[model samples]
Target: MHATQTPRQDDPLDVETFARPEQQRRFVAAMHRIAAERAPGSSVRIYVSIAPGDANCERWLECITDDLPDGVELLHYRTAFEGAAYDWDALASRLDGLVVIGRPKRLGSRVHVLGPVARLELRSLVATKPVLLFTHNHGLVPVVDCLSQVMPPEEAPRLKLIAPKRWNRESITIRAALDALRPTGVSNAGLESFRAVQAHLLTPFSAASR
Candidate 1:
């Protein structure tokens, strides 16, 4: 797939504006709100990634920028891969929270898959802070099934699934189910998580601590 926008400095997180004027306005407002609530200065930055076939990607982002509180430094990225194997950590390093909006597909009673990349990305992020995964599809439950096998209960709990529709069916392809499983030591925390986890890196948590 072609890279819609190459990584650049000073590029608006919205990148290209929405077709609808109201949509664009709403999105910008939300982002500003989030910025203000989350961070008052340039310390916190927001990064968004758009997956292939992700229909609501733009819409959700618009809402975030337009409706959410202000002072949020939101950045947007169009991903080239299906899983979090690419730039997941890079996007997570600068922000405090991540929002993955999608429809979940179920394989079993509680096993679901939202965005494969997002799940893996979140699983990777949990090594540091909490990641909230939101989806409206019933199939999203199984995405957490393998979590029990990877990390301890507490860590797994940090990777949450926000699914409004719960699935009761178990129709998982063996091959597909195996792909959803996460392996050990495969963390995507990036620099930020590491710093947060250690708490005393090259410098202190904040300049004041020094």
Candidate 2:
């Protein structure tokens, strides 16, 4: 099914819920402006790529499909391995943004994930597209280390890796971030956290850009 460009009727709290009406108006305007600048005259076809076992993927997709703007569409790709179904050329053509979502391993646990991807493709992907990743790991150093290798000093300005704004509320920080990356293009919706803080983070950007 196609994604809606406006907020859903069922959501109790959403982008429309600013601290005030002015904030909401500005935020919505900013969103439109940003969209106009990034993908003028072009329709975006987004493809979501995520690990097979991720429980949050469904929730993330629901959030995205419910509120994507006009001209933006979302697809899904679930797998056990990285780029398992990746069609490099097709993906390149389809996507303007990507979100890689994974959990942090407990210190004493044997399950290893997230770190390697950060070690390996973080930079390459960022260089190629706007990438936003969220994880529970406290090791920011490793993320920085990997980014330093793959990202150019100049382009580094475009990369961001941080905690979810408020954990879980009504903000679509992930959505906003994806919008920032591809403007008029495709985006990944595998790791969205729409908490209060995230909503705050997105407000100014959305308002100003629209």
Candidate 3:
């Protein structure tokens, strides 16, 4: 099935809880850097997936599309309802990378799982490419647990973990989590591309702060 770009749905009661200004800045900066690195005349195609019924979904969509960089296109997809099977592979084939926004819930002492639809999308998306998961209000451990559920047993443990020094307050922590997936060998090209984006996101901000 073809991936349809979901229209932005506005909910009056929905509050801006996840997509913070700083995080949005970092995300957009990273996308711009990714776009710049593309071969001349080529565009970067990024598939952004969000769970169905997430109040913050439209917020993220707007943050990504607003003033988006040239040569970078975002294809937005809201995961299908529970028990619905959409052809994720066909969609993944046309994308350069994947970004999944999830709200992880703690199930146990150290276990976490994304919502049903988000978890399903995460499982499908990660099978072909490394996924950058943007999570809210959760730490690295919960995020790692979410990834482990979708990754192979051997590869899951091999995955690395990187966190900014002040992970609790920095948006770079999300980027660091994505970087940690390098050892799993999801997609070398995708990872390398993101490495450049990560550098671009961090270096300039670090320099300016100094």
Candidate 4:
């Protein structure tokens, strides 16, 4: 299935909750503008790739501030609704780093299984870029193990994991999620605390250009 370019009806971006209407409008506009200017192999673009789900998925993309690496642009990537036909190749090749969010079910975790091709394509894309994965701790370890089967061994370290042990996933807001992900400086509590997660998550992104 092809991913739609617009927000899916089930979960629209709630960026307005965090910014003034004008500010939010401009921010959304700027994201699209940056995405529009992109052409294959043109400049570095950091795409927040996702599998569809709850508010945290939306929050993951919303929380990233405009302040980014020099000449780096940000955009969103999501697959089209199940069984909807569309293209994936062009965008897949352009991704520099993918910030994946959500607790994706593993192969044997559920009664039904998934197709191999889409999963393979996604793994291939991940193998080629820096991937910062945010997920429920239990679900992800298995998911990574499964990916290891398909992903190139040499590129494995480039895929980092971030699973907050003390976070309240049920109650956290977009601002809180972003705050929790932000990078904090060196110190005993500072760097290791939830506040520094965002900063640490971004540390390897610059390497994606290589």
Model 4: number of backbone collisions: 6
Clash counts per candidate, in order, are 37, 14, 0, 6
Top candidate, metric lDDT: 3
For 77-139, candidate 2 gives per-residue lDDT tens digits of 532224576555555455655545434345422122443433234445544444444343311
TM-score: which candidate is best? 3
> Per-residue lDDT tens digits of candidate 4, residues 54-143?
445544443543323333345553432234543556666665544454334552221112234334444665433433344433222112
What TM-score number comes out for model 3? 0.40
Q: Which whole-number lDDT from 0 to 100 does residue 89 have in model 4?
A: 68
> Which segments of model 3 are wrong by more than 4 Å?
1-38, 64-71, 78-85, 106-112, 124-130, 137-147, 150-210
Better of 1 and 2 by TM-score: 2
Give the per-residue Cα lDDT of candidate 3 at 205: 31
lDDT against the true structure, per candidate, is 0.36, 0.39, 0.42, 0.37
Instruction: Name the regions of candidate 4 deviating beyond 4 angstroms.
Output: 1-42, 65-71, 78-85, 104-121, 135-210
C-alpha TM-score for every candidate: 0.37, 0.39, 0.40, 0.33
Model 4, poorest ten-residue lDDT window? 138-147
Model 2, runs deviating above 4 Å: 1-39, 64-71, 78-85, 105-122, 134-210
Clashing pairs in 4: 3-80, 181-198, 182-198, 182-199, 183-199, 184-196
Cα displacement (angstroms), candidate 3, residue 159, comes to 15
Candidate 3, after superposition: displacement of residue 96 in Å?
1.1
